[model samples]
Target chain A: MLAIFVEMFSYDFILRALIVGVLVSLCSALLGVSLVLKRYSMIGDGLSHVGFSALAFAMVLNIAPLYVAIPVVVVAAFLLLRLSENGKIRGDAAIAMISSGALALGVFAISITKGMNVDMSSYMFGSILAMDNSDVVLSICLSIMVLCLFAIFYNRIFAVTFDENFARATGINAERYNALIAFLSAVTIVLGMRMMGALLISSLIVFPPLSSMQIFKTFRNVVLSSALLSVGCFLLGLCVSYLWATPTGASVVMANILAFLFFYSIGFARDRMKG
Target chain B: MSLISCQDVTFSYEGRNVITGLNFAVDKGDYLCIVGENGSGKSTLIKGILQLKAANKGFLTLGDGLRLNEIGYLPQQTNVQKDFPASVWEVVLSGCLNALGYKPFFGKNEITRANEQMQTLHISNLRNCCYRDLSGGQQQRVLLARALCASHKLLVLDEPVTGLDPVVTMQFYHLLKEINRAQGVSIIMVTHDIKEAVSQADHILHLHNKQLYFGSVSGYMNTALGKFFSGGGQDACNLR
Candidate 1:
């Protein structure tokens, strides 16, 4: 295994994969803070599936999948917001619609293009072992955009996400901030799908923030710790996958979940002992 | 001058009319206590005033001279919010977010204001504590302090002392009185504690069957419903 990793880790191919994973994880971690705060944990999952479905169609139509998928997922997120506001579906019922519908659509598109260079294994789990230059660049760009958004709108986002009514009475237009969250969620989901794949992507978004909230008492702590955990998970999982030729998305997601559970359980124990 | 006035404000949800055709008003520094049976629209009326839910049929004007930002609100504590993972400082700091105009970090002035509000609410020491880890009464104090941090003019609370002890309830009332007298902030509170509502409230709104008995606290307490409705037997401090 050491020999395997030493050889692969030196190769530019593995380096690119590592870069993509780390960058995407960082962005997802930031957005995960908002998603967890807003109680829209499921939206990240829903949008990722929508991206997957759009990816298949883009492939069949011979277009760049990110272009098609990003717009469609963003629109789907907006629709989810509108539908929920109108009471079209109550309490995450819309999430079920988007997740299941998008999953089925993805499978159907894949079946139609099944013979058109179908690398089912790679798409299902993630093709980190085979990532190209553009994927690495795309991930870097998304991460930078996410950081930029955070820098610019941190206060409004904090106010709206934590206590929306307070934001509103203070004249901070919560609806706009809520829309920003949904829009950012769509973009993050699209970029994240390439690294974690549709099947395992949401784990990074959910577990990092959840675990960080365990020991940290402040919103800023939760944000910073989650990003740190995410970067660490991505680097560790990438190394393991490069060494063992494991399923890349599953390996990373499992590693993140394990790390989260470990720390969360420790925090729980410490709290109990104190009590 | 009347800072807030309502006329025939009706509100409903899912076919049940909660607060029906209510009419009332609050002058600056008036502590209005609103009471009614469960599901009789006491909370609904409060929510209506805060614009949490708009009136379906009538109007509530927060006075034309005042901007929307002047009205402050403190919602009731819910069981679900008790587990929120935020600190007392963070919670109090959230109040200034609207005033600070969306900057990432808090500057010296915002920090000063937040600290002042917490100190005024007598919870400045709890600033470093986790909001969810505090007792029920402590949580209420934290939220009240948070409200005070942003409470520029109007202070609206929905059951401000829901689960607090009797002594704490009195302290809560005293704090409101201090805020009202010092800042000249008008307050309207929704409560189930009838005797306290009658005794402390400057004005009383006894809501029943889509009608509002709008008058001075003593006037309403002298009525038959107020005499009976002030928790007739359970209450020890009966009016002469």
Candidate 2:
């Protein structure tokens, strides 16, 4: 097992994937706590679908995918935020409409262009070799920015998520902080989608916090544990994928599912003991 | 000058007036209760006072060095907070975010203030406890402490005791009364419990799509609208 680990790390592409994967996992987990608590977890799913369309359009236009995808998904995220705030359209309904529409556009683009080639499939299902040296550098810088922003505004984010009306009453710009969360999530989604695929990237933003919430009762503890759990799961999933030759995205999602179940049972047992 | 004064304020939603012709003033150290039936614009009026909503045709003045952000607010519980994983300390300390301006972390002064507020609310023992694990009454106290941490001059409570049991509700009211009397903090509370509101508050503002009465509790008891809403003349005074 130790020799196998050494061999895997020796591969340059695997190392790059691991580095970016760990960073993306950490960022998503940190933002996930706020998103899940605010009932905005679906924003991740919606944004990833938009990311798919952006990637597809980029592929058709023969441009760099990240360059096109980042701005497009960010704009879609802001539009979704505005739509939800408008109150004319319910939040879930807006997400459903936009995500499905974007998915359709992506499918349409792909069918009309290269007819679902290997590169497009990699975008859909993710490939370990998809991340280049420049991609790794970009992911590192963006991930650090996300981390620092989350840390600096941690208190305000907590206040806004816990109670927006009360936060607003105290003169905290709840909408601005909410936009910040959406913005960070958009960037994280685009960055992670390269490795986790658009279909599975949101799991990074959802599973860790939920698993930690099953046992941890306090917000600080939940956030800390969620970050640790996300990184652990990503590494574990990477190892499994390397050893078994499975898809990286599905392996990571499966690892998360297992962790969630494990924590849930522990919580259940604790409750029974108390009773 | 009054701490807050609303002059003929009219608030509209989607171009339809939800509250109209609202005129009232909250003086320093005053305890005012706002009561109204469902759709009677009590919430709209509160929003207007809090500066969450702008009035279409009236002016709202905040005098006596009271900024909109300095008003301690204990809003009604939302579903999002019911299961939130937060420590009591985190929730209470968050009230100081407005004063924290540009500082990333809470200062020692803010920390000491949060501890003091927690002590005042008698929740010092529950500082590290998870918020969701507490009883409804305890949760309200945590939120009240949070609100108190924001401002020393005034408190704005929107149906603060909606879900607690009767015993807890009375205890909560007793705590608020103590705070109001001891600290000289002005309070503007919106509640559905008219009898309790009449007894606890020094002044009453009743609304029925408009301001029906705004005066001392005694004066409100004399008005026909207050008498009817307070469940009758003699019982209202007796409760007080």
Candidate 3:
């Protein structure tokens, strides 16, 4: 097993995929705690659908997919947030409308252009070879940016997530903080689309914090544990997929699901014991 | 000038007016209780004062070196809010976010201030407790302690004691009175319980069917509406 693990890193593609996967996991977990607590976890799923549609368009236009997908998804995220807040449409309704519409559009675009010479299913379910040297560098920089911004705004995000009305009353601009959260989630979702696939990317933004919440009682503890658990799960899933030739995205999500159930069982047993 | 002053304030929601032509001033160290029937815009008026809602027509000012974000607020809790996953310490420390600006983390003084607030509210031992697991009265005290960590000058609360038992309500009222009188922190609370409102408040702001009244408790007691209430007319506001 140790020899197999050592030989796995002999390939450059594996190394690149592992680096990008770990960084994306960390970014997603940092943003996930706030998003999950705020009941906006589904926004990740919604935005990833939008990213899929944007990627399809970029393929048709023969443009760099990341360049087009990042801004397009980010704008869609802001629009969704704005529409939800304006009371003209509810949050779940807005997400459902946008996500399904984008998914349909992506399907249509793919059928018309035959994915414009790109392997469409690979983009849909993710491909390990997607992380080239340039992709890895971009991923590193963006993940660092996300981590730094989250750290800088940690206290304010805590306030906003707890009670937005009270936070606003106390003179914090809750709307701005909310937009910041949406923006960060958008970037992470877009960056993660290549490895996790658009269909499976949201689990990265959801499962970690939820699993952490089962055992950790405080926000800080939950956040720290979530980050660590996310990276650990991703690494394990990547290695398992490499060994078994399984679908990487599904493998990672399965790992997270198992972790969630395990932690939930622990929490339930603890509660029962206390009783 | 008073610590907080609102003149000719009119608040509306979805283009429907909830409060109109309201004028009230909260002086330094004043304990003002706002009482009104349901749908009488009591919450709207408090939100307007907190600048959470913009008045359709009027000006609101915060004096005594208070800014919009510096005023502590303890909002009425909803079921979802009550289940938030945060520790008592995190909740209290969050009160200092307004002063953090672009800084990422809380400074030592901010943590100390949160500890002091927990101590003041008698919840220092519960700092590590999860907020959602606390009892209603304990949660309210934790929220009050969180609010106290903000400005320590003024607190705006909306229906803060709605779910507590009578004993907890009395104890909470005593805590508020102590904070108001001893600490010299001005308070503006909205309550449906007219009995506690009339008994504990130094000043009263009464709203009924678009009519507004603001004055000292003694002055309010002499008015026709106050006399009606003081004369055992418990159903006066609730009936409307």
Better of 1 and 3 by TM-score: 3
Model 1 residue B24 lDDT score: 84
Task: State the TM-score of the second chain for every model.
Answer: 0.89, 0.95, 0.93
Q: Where does the lowest 10-residue lDDT sum fall in candidate 3 chain B?
A: B230-239
Kindly report which residue stretches of model 2 are placed more than 4 angstroms away from their true locations once superposed: B232-240
Angstrom error of the Cα, residue A169, model 1: value is: 3.1
Of 2 and 3, the candidate ranking higher by DockQ: 2
lDDT at B49, model 3: 79
Q: What is the interface RMSD of candidate 3, in Å?
A: 1.3
What DockQ does model 3 achieve? 0.79
True lDDT of residue B55, candidate 3: 79
Q: Which ten residues in a row have the lowest lDDT in candidate 2 chain A?
A: A116-125
DockQ of each: 0.52, 0.87, 0.79
Model 2 pairs in collision: none
Q: Evaluate residue B84 in candidate 2 and report its C-alpha lDDT on the 0 to 100 scale.
A: 93
**Candidate 2, after superposition: displacement of residue A229 in Å?**
0.4
lDDT of 3 by residue, B186-214 (tens): 99999877667889999999997364679
